[model samples]
Target: MTRTILTEAGAQTAPSGDALWLSAADALRITGWELKPEGMCRGELCVPLPAGMAKDGQIDLAAFWGHIGAPLAHDAGGTVWSLGTAASERRQSLETLEAPDFTLPDLAGAAHSLSDLRGKKTLLVTWASW
Candidate 1:
């Protein structure tokens, strides 16, 4: 869950406080991942970004967020970007995916498909609060 940070031509990280500001477009270009005025691009996929760029030429933060179904948070100073949550649920690649399967027990104490609990042991555990 690492994020890319963009800076001026060769900005340095501050030793005691927040880093210097990066215009959104510059940040995106350098990282090769950005929510730009045209859209969000990674490798080759482009989602039609729905808002205009800011007066200063950065992508409009709020509109880009809305387009991606992601949430935004800003510090007291209003420096903001998508919280990076939207794509958190996405798969980085299809390298490891197994089919879904499961099983459960019935009140009669008989195990059912959960597929009939085939090739597996069905444990019946119950709990109650009185």
Candidate 2:
């Protein structure tokens, strides 16, 4: 059986094993990272995994997530899990302190650019009835 993991990026299914381990490939698919000899790498970034986190070709998912300061939550039945954004990403967002520029349309269908509000005190509010 496989466990379904829900992440902010999307959902992925990882092979199930004991209580703590997940296949390296499955873990990578869910986390966008691979456990290399150097470390857990995604693109050009690599964060070294502590000793014993990887064993017998599988990763200790809980320990790996904890080491990177990413939170994980599972349902009571252990059939589903949620992985939160890594601490590094959150730290980078805080360091930059700049919101990504985006464009959205108004009720009349006129598009507005966030950059247009630069240097002005703007209060942007959005609501959904759902």
Error of 2 at 44 (Å): 2.2
TM-score on alpha carbons, each prediction: 0.39, 0.70
What is the TM-score of candidate 1? 0.39
Best of the candidates, TM-score: 2
Models, CA RMSD each: 13.4, 5.0
Please, what is the whole-model Cα lDDT of each candidate in the order they appear? 0.46, 0.81
Residues 31-125, candidate 1: write the lDDT tens digits.
Answer: 34465455667667777754343445455544555566655554454332234435443443323443224455578887655554557665646
* Cα TM-score of candidate 2: 0.70
**In model 2, where is the ten-residue run with the lowest total lDDT?**
11-20
Which residue window of length 10 is worst by lDDT in model 1? 11-20
